[model samples]
Each structure stands twice: as C-alpha cells, then as structure tokens.
Target chain A: MLTKRIIPCLDIHERRVTKGVRFKNNIDLGDPVEMATRYYEEGCDELVFYDITASSERRPIDLEMVREVARAIRIPFAVGGGITSLDDMSAVLLAGAEKVSINTPAVLNPELIEEGARRFGAQCIVLGMDPVRSDNPACPSGYEITIRGFREYTGIDALEWARRAESMGAGEIVVNSVDADGTRAGFELNITRLIAENTGIPVVASGGAGNPRHLAEVFIKAGADAAIVAGMIHTGEYSIAQIKNELHQAGIPVRRHW
Target chain B: MTAIIDYGAGNLTSVKLALQTLGVDALITSDPDRIMAAERIIFPGVGAAGAAMESLRKLGLQEILHTVTSRGTPFLGICLGTQIIFQHSAEDGGVDCLGLLQGQVIRFAPADRRDKVPQMGWNAVSFVREHPVLKGIADGTEFYFVHSYYPVPDDDAAIIGQTGYAGVDFAAVTGRENIAATQFHPEKSGRAGLQLLENFLRWKP
Candidate 1:
C-alpha cells in the first residue's frame, strides 16, 4: 500500500523560514536547512520549500539555499516559486531537489508545463495552485484560481485548471486553499474533494491543517494523497512524531520510521 | 570507484548525493570508458523510455552495459533505468529496450478510480527471495516509488521483490547474477533507501 504523505512546507522569505496567517505578516522562524533537517529527522514523508516572495519580488529562487537544503536532507523535496523557465527547473533539479513546482508562470504561459514535462520527466514537475472559493457562475466548481500570492484572480475554474494541467503533464497538483490558508479551522474539504475526485493525478491538500485529526479527515474524506503542514508543526506545539502517531492511532497509513 | 551513469536522461545528482552521505564519493559520468572501468555501476535515470534509449545509444552505453554485466561487475538500475533494462516498453508508442533482462515493461491500467497513473509515493516491498543488495533490509519495508510503467520479467527467478499498486503486482526489485534493479528511487527513500545503497556498496555478487 502507498502510504499517505505528511509534508512540512517551509515558506522561505529572504532565505529564512517564515510563517504567516493567509500569507501575510510572516515572522522569521530560522534557517530553512535547519527546519528541513528537523522535519526529515522527525519522519515527515516529504518536504516542500516555497520561495514566497520570489514571484512578487520578480526574482529567481535562491539556488544556494536550495543546494544547502538538498545537502541537509536525504528524502525527496520539491522547490517552487519564481520558477519561470526550463533553466530554472534544470538548476533546481541539478541542485539535488527532486521536483520543481510552477504556479504563476505556469498559469500565464501554460506551455511551460508541457516543456518541463517533456524535458525532465513529468514525475519531476508539480503544479501548485492557490484556489479561493467563489460563487461566480463562470466557475462550475465555484472555486477560482488565483495567482501572485492570491492577490489576483484568473477567473479560471480550479477544477478545470487542474484537469488541463494534468493533461499538459503535471505529475501532481497541490491545491492550496487561499480561504483556508493558515486559518487552522480545517481544510477546505469541498474544494479539495472537488479537485481530487475530478483529476487522475495525485492531489496534495495544502493550507488549513490544524492537527493530526484534520490531516486524517482530509485524507479519508477528501481523498487527498498528501497534506501539507506548516503552522501546526512549526509552532513547536505539535511535533511530526506526535502527528504521525496520532494518524497511526486513527488508522491512517503513514511511514513510522524516524 | 562507482560510476553513476548520466545519459542525459534526468536527475542524477541526488543519486550521487545519497552515496556521498554513505561516505562513498561516486562519480556521475556519461563516458563509456569510465563506466566500463569502474568497480561498480549505478544506472540511474528518470525519463521516457524512447528518449532514454536514444540517449543510451547516442552515448554508446548499450554495449558497455552488456559487457559490464557479462563480466559480473555488480550493476544496479533505478526507476527509468529499471524499465529500460527489459526487452520492450509500452511507453512512447512501444519502445524496444535494452533487452538485458527477459521481460517487457507495461503501463498500469487501473480499473479503480482512485488509482492514479504515475503511481508516486512510498510503497512496501515484499521480498520473494534474498539478494546481497537487500541483505540488511527487512521484508515488507517501504521504499519511495514514482513511475507509470513497471517491468514484468519473463522468469520469476529474476524477481527478488514485489509490490502491489494500481491493481497490479509488479516487480519492485529484479536481477540475475551481478545485475540488480529497483523500480523505486532508493536514493530518495531516506533511511531505508540509504540502507539499500549502503548494502549495494558492500555487495559481493
């Protein structure tokens, strides 16, 4: 059986690990390499490092930081944010990161996804989207895709975009709910389920993870293959061991070796 | 010295880094001479079968691989490298592979809606028989896997480990004599993965 993944996302701002509520007013948490190593040692299935400010600031991802993190951890990790071209993807993969995620640039060009999948296998390409709930009649799923850190709306339906990205060769889709991001209320089950069921690719439920029970709910109810945790584990209140132990007790299959 | 083959397929840095963590500084190379001269060879790749086969031919590695395996130099394949070792692959409109092993690679046709293509993430491996590379690793230990096509060897003796996914029980580990291959990326599988590589380093067969 394939175990459900528990990934700890490290949102990097100026090479430091930062956390915020709904991507606003983030506080520095320390070195990304240190945090990534800690999470890997604690038995997190995988790791994701997003350069949160790279797209808005219009700069490439910090490759030095990527290289340092790649050296610090033995598990697979994905690097995203400000990955605009194939060269950017190549650099990140060569730096030892397994996958490169494209969000804003992918939405704008769309062909970048195909080219990346063609050059480097689709397994190394991940599509990260920030979707917010909307009541617009145009979006059949009632969720619209947002870009540039959720400050702008594309009016494209989240489910439609996910299907298109999968056809265009995205290996996995990370549905990071903008409305539920960092809220700790719970995962936006409706939207996550909508995308997970509609697409054939692996769906990683991101944003709004509060506890192990919340993760179990997303995995069992929403059909999520993986879930991302930031605030729940980064605050020092809950460790990865506790989270996985709780998931184990709840009967959700997760890797138990630390 | 171990040579990690780089045939312009996909990421080979992580494989080298994994070996580095085990205190073995493996070299990543595309040169046939270096690969032929190495004490061990790790053929690691992530790509389509057609493109990988083309690159392998372009770099003239097919014959080198054949000669190395025949010499019993202890060779290992990972991911795409595993699929390409078979006789043929169904990917990219039916690609004829290296035929190093008597098997054909086929894609998963899952009747279950939840079973996605390119089955990614960790899955447990059930050993059918013992091999030196998997000596210390316990049976039913999980390893990281990310692929759409899997190899089906013609001879069951070649299969050392098996895994079930997408309504198919496929070969997760297969080999004969000195040649062993894994459909999973042991380099990216953390502790258990590193253990497989460490065992490969010390493997005599």
Candidate 2:
C-alpha cells in the first residue's frame, strides 16, 4: 500500500525560514538547513523549501541553502520559487535536491514544464500552483490560478491548468490554496478535491491546515496524496511525530520511522 | 570503499550522503578503475533510458559494469540504474539497455486517473525471497519510488521482492548472484532505505 505523505514546507526569505499568513504578516523562523534536518529526523515523508521572495525579487533560489539542506537530510525534498529556466532546474537538481518546482516561471513559459520534464525526467519536475477561489465562469472549478506569490490572477482555471500541466509532463501537482493558506481553518477541499480527483498525477494538498484533523480531511475527503505543513509545525504547536501519530490513529497510513 | 557510478545524470549526491550518514565511505565517480576496484559498486541514476545509455557508452561504463558484476563485486542498481541494466526499455521509444540482466522494461498503463503514471510516493515491497541486501526489512515495508517504467525479468528466479501498483504486481527488487536492483530509490526511502543500504554495506554477497 502507498502511504500518504506528510511534508513540512519551509518558506525561505533571505535564507531564513519564515511563515506568513497567506503571504502577509511575515514571521521569521530559523535556518532552513536546521529546520529541514529536524523535520527529516522526525519522520516527515518529505520536505519542501520555497524561496518565497525569490520570484518577486527576480533572483534564483539560494543554491547554497539547497546544498546545505541536501547534505543535512536524507529524505526527498523539493526546491521551488524563482526557478526560471532549465539551467536553474539543473543547478538545483545537481546541487542535490530530488525535485525542482516551478510556479511563476511555469506560468510565464508553460514550455518550461515540458522542457524540464524532457531533460530531467518527469519524476524530477513538480508543478506548484497557487489558486484562489473565484466565481468567474471562465474557471469551471471556480478556482483561478494566481502567480507572483498570489499577487496576480491569470484567469486560468486551476483544474484545467492541472490537466494541461500533466499533459505537458508535470510529475506531481502541489495544489496550494491561496485563500486557505496560513488561515489555520482547514484545507480548501473544493479545489483540492476537484484537482486530485481529475488529475492522473499525485496531488499534494497545501495551505490551511490547523490541526491533525485538517490533514486527515484533505487526505480522506480531497484525495490528496500528501499535505504540506509550515506554520502548524514551525510555530511548535505540533511536532511531526504528533501529527503522524494522529494521522495513524485516523487510519491514514503515514511514514512513522526514522 | 564503495563506488557510486556517476554517468552525469540521476541523484548521486543524496546516495553518497546517505552512505556517509551510515558511516560508510562511498565515492561518486565515472572512472572505470575506481569503480572496478571498489569493494562494491552502486549504479544509480534517473533520466531517459536512451540518454542514460548514451552517457554510459560515452564514458565507457557499459563494459566496466558488466565486468564488475561478473567479477562478483556486489553491484546494486537504483531506479534508472535498475531499468537500464535490463535487456531493453520501452522508454525513449524502445531503447536497448546494458543487457546485464534478462528483462524488459515497460511503462505503467494506468486504467484511470486514480493510478498516476509516474507512481510517485511510498509503496510497500513484499519479499518474494530472502536476499542479503534486504535482510531484516519487514515484508510490506514501504519504500519511496519515482518512476514510470519497471523491469520484468525473463525468469521469476531473479525476483527478490514485488510491489503492486497501477493494477500490476511488478518486480520492485530483482537480484541474481552478485547483482541486485531495486525499482525504488533506497537513498530517499528514509529508515527502511538506510537499512537496505546498511545491509548492502555489510553484505558479503
């Protein structure tokens, strides 16, 4: 049986781990390498490090930080934010990360998804999408794709983009809800379910996880293959072991050993 | 010292790092002498079969790999390394592989959207028989996997373990004599993965 994954995401800013509520009211954390090592040791299935400010700053992800994290942790991790081209993708992968995610650059040049997949194999390419709820009929799923850290609306239907990206060779899709992110309410089940049920690839539900139940809801209700936690864990409100034990009791199969 | 063959593609750093964490000395190299002279050789990579094969040929590693296995140096293959060791691969529109083992690699044709193509995530491996490298790992212990194609060895005797996914029971671990290959990435599989690597380090076979 394939166990559902519990991944801890580290939103990086100036090489420090930071968490903001839906991209606002930023709270500085600690070093990424240290945080990543802690999560890995705690039995998190994977880790995601997003350079939150890199895309807006028009700079590539911090490769030195990536190298540090790679050397420190043995579990699989994905590095995203400000990955604009194939060279960037190669540098990140060669620097030791298992997967390289593209959000803004992917929307700017959809071919980047295809090219990255062609060059590095589909399993190495991850598509990180930030979608917010919208009533516009253009988005059949009522969720529109947002870019540049949720500052711009592309009017592209989230579900449709998922299907297109899959066709273009995206290995996995991280459906992070902009509306639900940092809310501590719960996952936006509507879009996560919509995309997970429709797409043939693995869907990682992100944003708005307040408790263990929220993670369970996304896994059972939304059909999410994995879920990302940042604020929930970073704030020390919960540990990865605590979360995984809760998931295990909830009957969700999660990796529990070191 | 263990040699992790570096033909330019695939996740080599993590493998080396994993070994180092196990307190084992491993080197990522393409030099034939170093790989052939090492106590063990790990042929690990991830990419298209055609391109991987091209890199191996360009670096003159094909013969070295064959020699390593034949000389009983205990060779282990991971993911792409496992796929290319087979006789042929359906990837890259029918690529001829290293042919170190008798098998054919085929892509997973999932019936619906529920079963993804790449089959990324952790899945359990059921032991079909005991092998040194996988010793002590319980049956149904899940390991991380990220690949679209899996190898079907010509003889069932080569299969040491099996995993079911996409409505198919495939050979997740295959071994015969000094060579063993896994469809999953042990280096990225956390504890169980490290255990497998540890077993490999101590494996006299």
Candidate 3:
C-alpha cells in the first residue's frame, strides 16, 4: 500500500533558501542543500522547491542547486519557477530532479504540457496552479486561476482547467489556493476537493497548513494524495517526524522514519 | 566499473550520483562498448517503454545489452528498465520488449486494484526469495516508485520480491542468475535505496 505523502516545500531565491509569507517579503533561510539534507534525514517524503527569483531575462533554472539538492537527498522532488521550454525541463531532470513543474508558461502555451509529457514521461511533469476565490457562474469551482505570483487573474475556471490539464497529460496537479495561502486557516477544502475529485492524476494540495491536523483533514476530507507544506515546518513549528507521528495516530498511513 | 545506461531517459544523473554517494565511482555512458566493457551495468529508465527501446536501438545498444546480460554480467534495471527487459508490454498499445525474462508489463487497472494508476510514492517491498541485493535491506522496507505498469512475470521462479498495490500483488523486483532488476528506483529511495545499491556494488553474482 502507498502511504500518504507529507512534503516540506522550500523557497529558493538568489541561490539561497528563503522564507516569505505566501510569496512576498522574504528572508534567507540557509543553504538549500543543507536544509534539504536535514529534511531528508528527518524522513520528508518529498520536497517541492520554488525558485522565487522573479526575472524577465528568460534564463534557465538553477541547475547547480538542483544537483546540490539531489546529491544531498535521495527522495524525489519537483522543481519549478522559470521552466519555459522543454530544454529547460530536460536540464532539470538531467540535474536529478524527478519532476519539473510549469506554472505561467504552461498556461501561456498549454501545448507545452503535451510536449513535455511527450518528451519526458507524464510522470515527470507537474501542473502547478495558484487559484483565488471566484463566484462567477462560468467557474464551477468558484475559483479562478491567478498568475504572476497570484497578482493577475486569468479568468479561467480552476476545476475546468484542472480537467483540461489532466487530459493534456499532466501526471500530477498541485493546487495552491491564493485565498487560503499563508492564512493558516487550512487548505481551501472546497477547491482542493473539487480538483482532486475530478482528476484521475494525483493532486498535491498546497498552502495554509497551520498544523498536522490540517494535513490530516486535507488528506482525509479533501482527498489529496499529498500536501505541499511550508510555513509550519519552516518556522520550526513541527518536525517532519512529529507531523507524521500525529498523522499515524489519526489512523492515516504516513511513512514513519524514526 | 559500473556504467549506467543513458538512453535519453530521465534520472541518469541521479543514478550516477547515487552510485558516487555509495562510494562506487560509476560512469554514465550511452556508448555500447563502454556498457559492454563495464564490470557491471545499471540500466535506468523513467519514460515510456517503446521510446526507451527506440533509443536503445538507435544507439545500437539492444544487442550489446542482451549479450552482456546473457554472458553472466551483473545487470540492474530500474522502472522502465525492468519493464523493457520483459517480453511484451501493454504500454503504447502493446509493444515488444527485450525478452530477457519471461514476463509482460500491464497497466494497473484501477477498477481491479482500487489504487492510483501511477502509485507514485513509498510502498513496502517484501522479499519472496532472498538474494544478495536484499543484503542488509530489511524486508517490508518502503521504496519509492513512480510508474503505471507493473511487470507480471510468466514464470514465478524469477520473481524475488512482490509489492501489493491495493491488494493486488505485482513483481517489484526480479532476478535470474546474473540479471537483477527492480521496478523501484533505488537511487531516489533515500537510505534504504542506497543500501541496495551498496549491496549491488558488492554483489558477486
């Protein structure tokens, strides 16, 4: 049986591990490789890294960081934030990332999803979405896709786009609710369940996990296969072991390391 | 030297790095001769079986791989590598594979198993029969896996380890003589994965 995945997400800005509220006002954490090693040591099931270095230059992803992190940890991880082309995807996978996630570029040109899946296997591509609250009749999920780090609304219905992305060959989807993000109220269960219920691919629910109980709720109620956690673990609120132990006590099948 | 076959597949570097971390200096090469000359060969895969076979044929490595494995050289195949070593696959609409073992790859039927198709996370691998690759690796230790198709060996003797996905048992590891392959990627499986690689490094068979 496959266990419920508990992921610890981290941000990489200017080649260093950084912390921020949702997506802004950041402070350096430390060396990404060191942090990754510590998390892997503590039995983090997986890691989701976001290169939050906003740039207009069309540069490549940080291959050096990918290699360093890969050398440090043995678990699978997904890297995102400037993956604009298939060549970039290949480079990231070659640098030892198990998967490459596309956000804005995937939305701008949806064909890239099909092509990336066609080139690298669908298992290597993750569809990341930052959605905000919406109640438009056209949007069934009542959530709209937001880009540019949650500043711009695309008017695209979150659930509809999620179905389309699955049909387009996305092996997994990461739903990070902008409204629920950094609020610590918990994941937007409605939106997360909406996406998870409709798509056959694994759904990773990101954002607003205040504690381990929040994760248990996301996995049990929302039907998320994995949780993209940050703030709680980032702020030393709970270690990966403590969180997994709590989930285990809740009768959730989480991998036990210690 | 152990050479990891790179047929334009993902995780070639991770396999090499895992080998390095295990203190075994392995080489990542697509050349046929280097692969044939290596003391041990690790074929790693992360894509479709048909395309991987195409890449192998394009580089003229299919025959060399067959020759080396049949000639009693230790061979380790991961994921698609293990699937391609079988006779046929249902992926890409029924494609023929290397036929090194008596098995066929089939997609996980969710209705039958009631589990996710990809099964993309840590799962317990129980040893059916002990082999050197299982050295120091505890039984039922979870290993990372990311795939939709699981190999169903025609002959039960070749299957060494089995993993249950939603109550359906599938061959997660198989071996016959010198050829040993795992459906899981040991490179990406953390400490336990490293231990398997270390055992493979010293595997006499």
Candidate 4:
C-alpha cells in the first residue's frame, strides 16, 4: 500500500544548513552533508533542500552543496529556490538532485512549469507555494500567496494557485504555510486538505510540525500525501523511526525498515 | 565500463553516481562509438518523451541505441527511458518511441478519486514473474516512483513486477531479452533500489 512520507527539509544559505523563524532571521545549523546523512540514518523517507539565497543572488542552485548532500544519502532529494528556467532545472538535475522545485519563478512565469514538465518531465518538477493568512479588504482568510521567501505577495488565492499549478503540469505541490512555519503548533490541516482536495497532484504539507503525533495528525486528518519537517528532526525532538512506528500504530501504513 | 546515454535528459548525474558507488566505471556520453564500446549501456531520462526522442534524433542516438541493443549488450532504462522503449507515448499526442518492446505508454487514470495522477513518492511492488534482473529482489518491497504515464506491455510476459494504484496493478518493471527497464528511479530509491541496480549489473543476458 502507498504510505504517507515524512520528509526533512534543509534550508541552505551560503553552503550551510540554517533554520529560522518564519523563513527569516536565519541561524546556522551545521554542515549540510552531515545533517543529510544523519536524517537518512534516522529513516527519513525523502529530503528537500532549498537554496534560500538563490533568488537574490541571481545564480543557479548551489551545485556544490547539492552534490555534497546527494553524495551523502541514497534517499530521494529535491532542490529548489531560484529555479527560473529549464537550464536551471537541468543544472540541478545534472548535479545529482532527484527533483527540482520551483516557487516564485513558477508563479511569476507559469510557462516555466510547463517547459520544465516538457523538458525535465512532470514528476521532476515540484511547485512550492508559500501561503499566508491575509485579512485584507479583499481576501478575508488572508489567502494571498507569497514568493521569494515570503517577500512578495502574488495576490493569488492559494487554492486557485494549486489548481493552476496542476494544470500547468506540476506533478507535486508543496504547501508551505507562512502562518504555521516555525510555530511548531501543527500543520495547517484545513489549508492542506483544501489543496489536496482541489488538486490531483500529490500534496506535500510543509511547515509547523512539532512531533510524531503532528505527523500522524497531518497524514490522517489533513489527507496529505507527505509531510515535510525540519526543526523537529534537526532539533532531535523526534526520530524518523519513531515517527513511522507511531504512524503505523495509528494505522497510517508506513513502510518498515526491518 | 558502462556508457550512460546523455541526450540532454535529466537525472544522469545520480545514475552515474550510483554506478560509481557500485565501483563500475561509468561514462556519460552521446557518442555512438563510446556507447557501442561499453560493456553495458544505461539510458536514464527524466522529461517529455517527444522532446527526449527529438534530442536523441538530433544527436543521432536512436540508431546507436538500436545497434547496441541488437548486439545483446546489457541495457537498463530508467523512468522516462523506460517509457520510451514502448511503441508510442500518449504524453504528446502519440509520439513515436524507441519501440524496443511491444507496448504503448499511457497516462495513469485511476478509477478512484483519491489516487493521484503522477503517483509521486514511494510504493511497494510485488513480483509477478521470476527473472535474473530481479533475482535477489523480494516481493512487497517499496520503491520510489514519480511518473504520470506507465507502460502497458502488449506481451504480458515482459512484466516482472507490478504495483497497485486505485486497485489496478500497473507494470513496475518490464524486460525483454537483454533490455530491462523500471518505472521507478532506482538511483534515488535507497538500499532496495541500489540492490536492484546491483542485480542488473550482475544479470546475464
């Protein structure tokens, strides 16, 4: 049976793994390779690396860091941030990254997603969405989406954007909630469920994971295909084996190693 | 030495790294001579079938692939490479494929609404038939897969493994003669995936 995945996301800036409060105020963690290897041994299903500085730097993904992490683990890894064109996707794929993620770029130019799916295959292209709750005069739920590390609001509805991404050939959608990120309260189940219900693509819920129960809650209540975690795993609050076991106990159908 | 065909498709780096991890000397090239001279050939692709075929034609690799595969050199196709072995793909209005096997590639349309189209992430596979390529592989082992289209073989005997999606068992692994292909990206599939690659390396055509 297909099971929900527990992914660990590593944010890379200047070749170092870092974690922050709501995608800002970065604090360096450690070497990416070491961190990635640790997660693999801990039984992580997959890994995601976001080059947080790529957009501002105006450069391609950091292939060196990508190579380091790729060399460290055998599990599937995805690289995102500042991916603007097919050439960028090709470069990341050539760097041993299994998948290339597109966020602001895909939102800005929807053709990037289409061309990416055309050139690199749909399965290899992931659309990353950062949604914030906006209570403005227009959007009551604060459903406006943001790009480039929550720096710019695209004024696009999150659910509508997810649907558009699927139509644009996005194979998977990573819904990162700005409100829930770094809060560690839990995943925004309502938002995740909305995206999952609206799109046929696999929805990976990112942000606001605190513990194993949180993982189970998201998988069961939110109807997410996968849950992305970073701080919980990085801080040693939970292990992958423990999370999978808990999910299994809760009837989540996770794959066991033994 | 293994020649990894490089016609501007994605995921060649990981495949090459996997081969190297197994201590096999692997070279990424589009040259027909280099590919023909190798002990084994690996065709790794991650992109549209039509565009990939176009690139292969542009680089004159279609003939090279045909020539090498005919000579009984071990060939392994991964992901999109696997899809291209069929007669045609429904991805881009029926694009012609390499036709190494008798099959047509079609998008996975799950009857269940819960089942996604791409079927991204890891899923378990059950072996339906025994073959050297899957020698040490066990039934009910999970492998990572990310694709929208799956191969529907004309000859059912070509299928070695199958996975259920929305209650329909789909081909996970397909083979004929010296050629074998997997819908999953073995290079990214962890220990089981590595073991499968090892089996391919040791497989006798």
* DockQ list for all candidates: 0.75, 0.66, 0.64, 0.56
Point out where model 2 deviates above 4 Å.
none
Name the regions of candidate 1 deviating beyond 4 angstroms. none
Of 2 and 4, the candidate ahead on lDDT is 2
What lDDT is obtained when candidate 1 is compared to the true structure?
0.92
Query: TM-score of each candidate?
Result: 0.98, 0.94, 0.96, 0.91
Better lDDT candidate (2, 3): 2
- Ranking of all candidate structures by their DockQ, best first: 1, 2, 3, 4
RMSD of each: 1.2, 1.9, 1.7, 2.5
Per-candidate TM-score, chain A: 0.98, 0.98, 0.97, 0.95
Clashes of 4: 3
> Quality of candidate 4's docking, in CAPRI categories?
medium
lDDT of 2 by residue, A3-45 (tens): 8999899999998988888788888899899988888888888
Interface RMSD of each: 1.1, 1.6, 1.9, 1.6
Tens digit of lDDT per residue, candidate 4, span B1-205? 8788898876677887877778887899998889889888888887778889999999998888888899999999999999998889999888999999898998987888678877777888889888777777678888888788899999999898998876678899998899999998888788778888888888779
Best by lDDT: 1
Question: What's the true lDDT of residue A156 in model 1?
Answer: 94
Whole-model Cα lDDT of every candidate shown, in order: 0.92, 0.90, 0.87, 0.85
Model 3's DockQ score: 0.64
Better of 1 and 4 by TM-score: 1
Best model per DockQ: 1
Candidate 4, A135: how far from true, in Å? 2.5
lDDT of 3 by residue, B110-190 (tens): 764226678898888989999999898888888999998999999999999999885579999997999899999898888
Model 2 lDDT tens row, B105-179: 999987866777788888889999999998878888889998889999999999999998888999999988989
